[model samples]
Target: MYKETLSSGIIIVPMQQEHAEQLEALQRIVFPNLAEEELLHADQYKKHVELFPEGQFVALDGDKVIAATSSIRYHFNLNDNEHHTFFEIMGGGWFTTHEPNGEWLYGMDVSVHPDYRSKGIARALYRARQYTCKQLGLKGQMTVGMLNGYAAVSDQMNIDEYYKKVKNHELFDPTVSVQEKVGFEIVGLMKDYLNDPTCGNAGAVIVLDAGKAI
Candidate 1:
């Protein structure tokens, strides 16, 4: 089993069946604008552990599920031409597309409770994902990060310009910028990525290599 305790006192561990309900509740708190179907309910969380326990993780403050990240192994080459929506990629929360022989760990979701946003919870969760990737001998960790800050500047620029600005360090995106801080890099942008008004329903594909996972 994989586990770690950050300096800030949060515990990171593999997601288990017992954590399902709290995780479901955590999702609502972190992403209030998303539809219920887009969020993984309790049953889906259990299925995630069942399908790929090694690829899923949660961060806890005491016994409360304060943060989590769900992932699946997939073999696709991380490229600019590829495209897929969050719902279709997540298999509607069931993670049915998890390929046992896949070469990459695909992050389906990573969320932190509002009260614990800047306490290193997200960075810890990401490190856990990278640790899992190296353990599985995967090529790297990949995620379609929702452009959570895009909505704030939508009228000022198009998604492409916004992407360049963020990539160039001229803009700060709540989600992507944080991922970059943790050593992931911007590779491409995804449009109509999810039903998220806050992000203009777009996503950015970010990646981190296996050698750098830990």
Candidate 2:
């Protein structure tokens, strides 16, 4: 039950079974574009807590969960050339790929309620993840970041071009931009990372060194 005060009334805590229902509802609200089969259920939450309790975290305003980040450890060879999709890396979305002796922490998802956007909740969750990685002595943290603002400009430029623009600060993507600000660097791009139409079926693989000076 680790807790971190975010503000006068907000805090972050390890996800517990008691937060299952709220977590499910919050996922639906945050990722409404995801297919029904893609959204997590209460039972899944229970499984997550059982598999790796320390890897899951939730942000709250008193008793209400406002944001969450799910993660799992995996044996990732940063030198490997084999490109893996989100489902493949996540073991078909069940996080069954988690390896206790894995070298890196793979962030499965981070969801913040729309109403709470730009409130520093997501940044706080990321800081917690970095702390977890360092404490576990893992190599680092990795995630496929969605390009939340891609759709609007995708037709005018290829994904690669857009990505370059983002890297050069000529473009801004709601999701990737925040990730960059948090110290994550784009490793590459992924296709079919998620079914969400907003991202144009692509995402950016971002990585951050857990032991890097903050």
Candidate 3:
């Protein structure tokens, strides 16, 4: 039941079952290209809260949910041999993979409504994640960041080069660039991370150290 008020009057708080429908509606707008199978249905939100309520959060303006982020705990090793895809790591959207004694917070998704873009809502959600990591004494945070806006240049560059460009500030990927700004570093890329054709069926493995955030 954490709460914070942003300067713009948006309120950030732990997600509740009451927010399920609003969260599902916002997900449609925020991730319009996501496959139906990949999207979490409204009922799943209740499972998320029951499993790990502390890692689920939402941003609201009045009664409307404008942004949200979900995370799960997992014993992750960056050098592990198992080449887990996003779906495998997330337990098919139900997050049944969440391990109670895990070392890292695996960020499942961070979404902001189309109307709330560029308003710092996403960053605020990330800061909340960092706070959670610090409080729980977790190692850090991990995510498969979307390479939004990568389709336009996919024919001109490979995924690695595109990631480098985003890291070096040579490219302005809508998702990765913003993630890099918040301290996540690209460890590598994964194939078939999502159903989005725009990103060339790739996603970046990004990590942020909790000590640095603290």
| Among all candidates shown, the one with the greatest TM-score | 1
Q: Is 2 or 3 the stronger prediction by TM-score?
A: 3
Runs of candidate 3 exceeding 4 Å displacement:
none
Q: Write the per-residue lDDT of candidate 1 for residues 1-214, one digit (tens) a residue.
A: 7889988888999999999999999999999999777999999999999989998899988999999999999987765447888888899889998999999899998899889888888888888888888788989999888888888999998888888888889999989998888889888888888998888888888889988844
- For residue 95, model 3's alpha carbon misses the true position, in angstroms, by 0.7
In terms of lDDT, the poorest run of 10 residues in model 2 is 77-86
* Clash count in backbone of candidate 2: 0
Q: Worst 10-residue stretch by lDDT in candidate 1?
A: 75-84
TM-scores, all candidates, are 0.96, 0.94, 0.94
Order of models, best TM-score first: 1, 3, 2
Q: Which pairs clash in the backbone of model 3?
A: none
Instruction: Give one digit per residue, the lDDT tens place, for model 2 in 1-214.
Output: 5778976467888999999999999989998888766677778887888998878999998899999999999877656535776667766657788898887888989999888888888888888888889889998898889887888997898777877787778998989988998899887777777778788777888888997643
Error of 1 at 114 (Å): 1.0
Top model by lDDT, which number? 1
Instruction: Write one digit per residue (lDDT tens) for candidate 3, span 73-132.
Output: 988888862567667777888889999988899999999988887888998898888888
